[model samples]
Every structure is written in structure tokens, then in C-alpha cells.
Target chain A: MNSEIVAIDDWNVPHKKSDGVRNRKDYLERLLKTERNMKDDAEPLVSWGFHHYFHGELTRQDLDLISKDRPILIIHRSFHEFIMNSRALSLFNITEDDLNHLSKEEKKFASLEEGHFSERGLIAVMPKVMKYLAAPQRLITGLQITENYFQENGITLIANPGSMYNPSIQKVKNYVFGDEDTPFKSLFIPSALYMLEHTDISNLLKTTEDHLSWGEGKVGFLPKHIKLFTDGAMYSQNMVLRDGYLDGHQGAWLMENDIFREAFKLYWDAGYQIHVHQNGDSGLDRLLDVLDENMKRNPREDHRTTVVHFGYSAFDQIDRMKKLGVIVSANPYYVSVLSDLYSREGVGYERSQQMVRLGDVDRAKIILSLHSDMPMAPASPLVLMHAAINRINYAHEVAGPNQRISALTALKGVTLNSAYVLGIENDYGSISPGKYANLTVLSDNPLSIDPLKIDKINVEATIVEGRPFK
Target chain B: MKNFIFVIALISFNVFSLCSNDRILVAKELVTLDDLYQDANAVYIKGNKFHSIGSKEDLIKKFPNIPVDHLYKDSVIVPGFIEHHVTSTASCNNNEF
Candidate 1:
């Protein structure tokens, strides 16, 4: 991605702060000008990385005032919400008549007046927007950049859990990523919730199994693995908490409790490796309860049921995870970027500082891996390792010293343990006999370097199947 | 006849070894993450698999005739990194958002 695009996509960039736009009006003005300059004025402007925590909620009036002639849609940083201008609403043809068709619960989240949609509301409108977002060329270009980005960071393999179920998108992915020229291989794990949305529970497994043929040269579906979501994203501050948010705002669930349970049981009985995207302690509570219930109903040993994006797990949950044979693939970047701000405003300091709580996971001997969750954080393993090892926030203060892990352990999070989470450890992850000759050459050893400088260690080259890519 | 059989066996062994894609990757350090060879300075590659890993001198002694690539002699080598939980649509979503 280009620097200008990064400036628009990342809130932490110097452009957002140095542009001298403080209030909503100035911010909207700058955003409109920058976006218009980037794309044609008549073309719809869809941008991400808008956070209410930093700039407060933006209304239709704020956006429409600046972008009166052009269409604009600003996706929340979490990708769970959207705020659009009047023109954008017209462009998408979203009207009150359409809103009337939605169920009352869904309507509550979609407001035509405010031009804001979230969770169920966003789901309701996604089809209308996806055509533009998932355009073949657009997706191809984005994926080409992603491939280069991964290779530059010495990533030889990337496993995308909860990949979209759209065949067209998958075809585009195959075009770019499945090419033999691509250095890294991609494994797509089907999303249980996405499948359930398009097909009945009876055909869910069949639909998932159909994706097995999607692989070409370098892209393939990870068989017998499915992804499920419990709560909303932590970035939106919508993750369900045990004690609730300090501001008294309630969190939302991505999947209803009964539906999540039914889906979990279906995959569990089918002998699939289940990966749950859980954030808050309350969400973890629900996940653990379901796992325990399933275990009692039909005990399965060495299941390797993984908990993904463990954003705010409790201390006791670690022991429960061990007992349930659950491993973790956590986004340590949450503590690195959001901990300080969330501590002051969102969840209060205690829970915010302990967002990832990986140290506790490590202490319990639970297998732990780290992920960028990509647009949530840069897809750099070194960055993830730095966050895990140092636990340092944007202010350069360690949010939770107790949660810090050793450098070697942190390295495992991005290498061996990460492959274990994907159930591909035998072939990838480590430099072992009979495994693929995949090695990442680094400027320095992460285990011997300063924890704070781990991210600074440059990737010299990556060897994939005995072929080196520099 | 026994001496002739011995010569044939040695020739077959040498031919087999030469035909295989074998090489030793000499690096400043190899963080194998393999339990038996946690840290080493050399890795023997046979085709697309890691045949063995040990100190440079040891691997050299074992496979004396194998080609050695000192290209990464100044760099540290570790297992290829894996991204366990990224979405393929994330980049598209970022660009098209």
C-alpha cells in the first residue's frame, strides 16, 4: 500500500494529527478533499479506520455537509459499522422503505437519518456495498499488494480463518495468490457463520466441503477447520465485558447465543477444528460454557479448538482453556495500540491494560500464537512479537508487565505455535526434517535482541520450497 | 568378484548422492525451533525438505561433497513465519472501505 493510502487507512499516522484538523467540521473537510484527490469526484469514496474513541461518532449531517455532491462511506475501524453521507445513501439506494422491510431488531441498528449501520444493520446492507468493494480488479490489486507485503515481511505461509464464502472473491484471490509466482501459500478456513447465513444447517458441512476444490497452486482451503464468532470487535468497543463498559454502553454479539451453540455443536460433531473469534470476558464465558457442554455431550480428545483474537480474557479462563484443550491465537496489537486510550475512556484502566492477557495464557502452558488480524494491525510478525514481548503501548509504557512473554516464546507465537493453531505444523512452522525447506532470514536474532527493538529487525529474505525471495 | 561388487556399490552411492538436490545452507545462526537441534549454524537441504541441521563444521564433515551456500552467512535464519488469523479480504476491505 502507498503512503497516502496508509495515511487514510491508519489513524495513528502523522497525517491525521498534523493536518491540523481537530473538530468534526475540519476533519470532514480534510477527509473529503483527500479522498476526492485520491479518486474521481463522482466515484464513491469508501474508507476505513474511523474510530469513535479518537474523533467521536460522525453523523450523516457531518459527512453530507462536506460531501454534498459526492457519495462517501466511512467504515468503522472494526469493520463492523458504517457511517455514510446522504449521497452515499442515495448511491446505495438505501431508503426508509428498505428499512421498513428489516426486522425491528435489525432496524434498531440501522438508522436512515444518521446514515449509520452496525452489526445486524451492516450485515443487512453489505450486499449492496460489496459489489464495489469486491470488484475483481480492485481485489486483485489489493491482493497483489498483500502478497508483496507478506513476502517482504518474510511470511512464507498465511492461514486466513473466516475467509469470505463468495466464489467470485475466492476466484480473484486464486488469480493473484494462487499464482506460482506468489512466494507464500494461503490457506482459507471457512467461516461457519457465513456458511450458515447462505445455507441451511444440514448443508453447512457440504457447503464448507465444496470449498476444498478452490485451491490452485498456492491457495487452498484448510479442510476440517471452521471459524465462528461470539462477540463484536474490540476496536469498536463492542466486545462484551463481564462488568460492562464504564460508560454504561452495552456490547453487541456477532452471533446470537443459541445460534452460536447450535453451530458449534454441528461442527464439533462433524469433527472439525473450531476457531472462535472471542474478545470480552463475557464472550469467553459463553465460549467456555459451550465447549464444556459439548465436551460432556461427546468428549473429543486433542481437539485443538482454538480461541482467536483473545482480546480480554479473564485469569480463570486460562485454566479452563487448558482443561478444554483450547489453544489461543491472540492479537497482541490490541494492547500495543488501544490499551492506553481504552484505559482512559472505554473499559477503564484495569481491564484495558490486561486486554490480551497472554502472559496468563503462557503461565497455564496453553499453546499461544499471535496474529495481526491485518487491517486491525499491520501484518508483521515482528510487530506482533514486539507487542507480545514488550507489552508496550503507544505511550511507550508497558500496559501489563506481567503479561509480557520471553523473546523465544514470542517467536514461537509467530512461527511454530502459529502453525500449530492452523493444524499445519508438520509441514510448515519449523525447520525440521521432512518438512518444507522454508526459512526466513532475518537481520538479527529475535531471541538475542532487545525486546523493544524486535520490530526493527529487518527481514533479509524468505526461502519457500528451496527458492529464495528477496 | 567381491572387490568388483564393492566398487559398484560405492559408485551407486556416489551417483545417488550426486543426483539428489543436496546443499548445506551456512548461516550466522539457525534458530531451528526443532527440539533436537534448537540452534545451529548450518542446515542440510535435500530437495525441498530440511535433511538435517547442526554446526557448520559437523554438517560439512558429514556431507563433504555437498555444495554450501554462504549467501546468508551474515544473517540469522529461523523458521518461516506463519500468520494464523488474518483475513484475505482485509486488504480489499481497507482499500475499498
Candidate 2:
């Protein structure tokens, strides 16, 4: 994932003052102008990066002003919810009659009057929308750019823990990322959530086993690796918290607790390394409980069940993680961008500053890795290391000084430890004999440099399999 | 005398053949991140794997005829970075049309 392409949307409208779109009026005008400029009138106007906090709550009525004729779908920044205008509803052939067929729980996520969809509701409409979103040429173009972006940032390998299971999309990915010319290799870890939604429960293991053959050249699936989700996105403040939000809003669960437990057990019994997308303390608590229960019922050593995006973890949770043998792949950029604002509005000063507490994780002697979550943060290892080491927030103040880690530890979080998290350390990671000749040449050593200057270090070139790429 | 000459010739031939394809990468410093050779300044590539790593002089002396690439004489080389998490669908969801 090279860049998150957020179209002319209002998520960052307040932040984009110079773009001449300060409020919803300016945003709507811009959207209308963009729609008018479209050469193909039939093409649905789809945009992403819509946050309710910044853009305010939107409805079909608000969007109808742009065009009641052309279809418009604006995805929430979390990618879990979306709002569609009246024409979009008509274009997708979704009506009140169709919505009436949904279950009570499903109906809660889908509002026909508002033309809004979230979670399961979003999943229900995704097939139709994905045909447009993941079009072959579009994915190919984005992946081509992604290849360059990876090479430019000195990344030799990237693993998508929860990749789409579309064979057509995989073919496109294989065409681009799997090409011999591409400098890096990509490993995919299939999502159990996707399997539950798309395939028969009995065929989950077989379906995952089939993905081993999905790999061609540089793109492949790692065997015995599966991903599951606990809560919603951190960016959208949808992550389920222990004590709820300051404004009395409740966070959402991506997967219900019972379902999450069932999936966790299936994978745990089958000896698969389960990687979970968890953001809040409540989510973590549920995850720990499931893990603890599974360990007691059927003991498995070195499970390496990793918690991805350790968004809001309590200090005690770290001890539990260590005991349960769970590692973490944290996104420190949450502190860099969301700390100040979230402190004031979302979780209060204490929890907000303590987000992505790698220092505590390290002190506990737990294996910690840092990631971009790419479009969630810039897909830059140096930048990730800088954030982890400095703990600097948007306001130039260190959010959690005690949570700051050493430069060497931060470096490992991006390299060796990251490879370890993926269970590919022997083949990749450090510069050693018999491992792939993958080296990232830099202008300065991240370990020896000033912690603040880490992000400024230039990537001179990259050597993959003993072949250098600039 | 003939057997002695043949033995010497065989040893020389073996040395030349081994060094023929090897390329010594000599940098000012090598952050090998390996326990045994943690602070080495040079590494010789045999095919696509590191054959040996040590000081520049030691590597050259050990593998005499191997060609040396000093392009990164001023740079630091670390393991190629690994990105542990990324969603391909999220990346391809660039609906910026």
C-alpha cells in the first residue's frame, strides 16, 4: 500500500485550509465540481477519509445537494462505514424493500433513510462496490506505484496480514508485485474473518491451505498463519474501550466476542499463528481472555499470537501478554498524530498519551515490532523508528516520555524483530550468511545518529538477493 | 616433482575458481547485526549470500582475487526493512477517479 488516496472529502477539510475547502459547503461545492468534470457520468463518485469528528455526521440528504443524479459513496476514514447519496442507492439497486429483508442487527448497521452503512452493512454492499474499487487496472496502477514506494523506502519485504481473497485481484497482484523486476517479495496471511464471511466454516482450513498455491514469484501466502479482528479502527475512534469515550459514545466490535473466541480456538487447535487487529483495552481484555481460555484447554507453546495495533493497552495488559506469549506489532504514529486531539476529546490526557506504549512492552521483555499500517501512517521505517524513539506528538511535545524507547530497540522494531514477528527471521532480518542478501543502504546509521534525525536519514539504495536497486 | 607441480596447480585453480564470481562489498562500516561479526567493515558476496565478513584488509587477504565494490564506502548497510502489517485491499481502494 503506497499511499491512501482520499478523494475530495471532508475528513481533513479543517486541516486542508489552503485547499480552499474549509467547511461542508466548500466540500460539497468541490465534490459537485469534481462530479461535473467527470467524463463518464455513469461512473460512481467514490471517496474515502470521511471522519465524523472532523466532517460532522453526514446523511444522504447532505450529499444529495452535490448531485441527486450521479452516485456518490464516501467511505469513513476507518473503511468500516460509508454514506451514499440517493442516486448511489438507486444505482446500487438498494431500496427500502431490499433493506427490509435484513435482520434486526444488520438493520442497525444499515440506515436506508440516511443511506449509511457500517461494519456488516458495509460488508454486505462491498461486493458491488469492490468491483469498482478493486478494478484490475486501478489495482495494477496502485500496486506499481506501491512497488516503487517500497523500494524507495528501502523495504525488501512486506506482509499483508489480512489480504482480500479474490483470485482476480491476486492475479493482478502477482502480475505487478510478483514480477521478477520487482525488488521485494510479499507474503500474505489470510484473514479468518474473511473466511467466515465468504466461505463455509468447515472449509476454513482447506481454504487457507489452498492459498499456499496462490503465490507466484514474489507474492505468496504464509502457511499456518491467520488474521482475526477484535475491534474497529483507531483512526475512527471505533475501537472498543474499557471505560467508553468521554462524550459517552460506545466503541464498536469488528467481530463479536463469541465469534472471535470460536475463530481463535479453531486456529489455535489447528496450530496456526493467529494475528489479531486489536485497538482498545476492552478489545485487548477480550483477546487476553480468549487466549487464556485456549491455553488452559489446549496448551500450545510459542503460539506467537500477535496483537496488531496495540492502540490503548493498560500496563497490566503487558504482563498478561508476556505470560500468554503474545507479541505486539504496534503503530507508534497513533501518538504522533492523534495524541493531542484524542487527549482533549476522546480518552482524556492519561490514556491518550500512553497509547502504543512500546517502552513498557520492551521493559516486560516482550517482542515488539513497529509498522506503518500504511495509509494509517506513512509507510516509512525510519519515520516509525523516529516516532517510537522520540514519542513526539503533533504539538511538538513528547506525549509519553516514559514510553520512549532506545534508537537501537526502535531499529530492531523495524528490521529483525519485525521479521521475527512474521516468522521469517532465518531467511530475512539480519545480515548473516545463508540468509537472503537483502541489505538497506543508508546515509547514516540509525543506531549511531541522534534520535531526532532518524527520519532524515536518506536511503542510499537497497540490495535484494545480492542485486542492488536504486 | 610432477606430482608436486600438479598439486600446487590444483590448489591455485581451486582458489581462482572459488573467487571468480565472488564480489567483496567494502564499506566504511558494516552493521552486520550478527553476533560473531558484529562490527565488521567488509563482506564478500558468494553468489547471493554473504561468504565471509571482516575488516577490509582481512577480507581482501582471505579472498585475494575477488573484485571489490566500494560504492557504499561512506554508507551504512543494515538488514532490508520488513513491514509487518499492510492491507492490499486498503491500498487498492484508491477510488480517486
Q: Each model: TM-score of chain B?
A: 0.70, 0.68
| RMSD versus native structure for model 2 | 4.7
In order, the interface RMSDs are 2.6, 3.4
**Candidate 2 residue-wise lDDT, A132-227, digit = tens:** 667787788777776777788888889988877778888988999888888888999888777777786678889888888998998999989999
- Output the lDDT of residue A212, model 1: 99
**Residue pairs in clash, model 1:** A46-B97, A47-B97
When only chain A is evaluated, what TM-score does every model earn? 0.94, 0.92
> How well does candidate 2 score on lDDT at residue A420?
89
Best by DockQ: 1
Model 1's lDDT to the true fold?
0.83
Worst 10-residue lDDT window for candidate 2 chain A reads A9-18
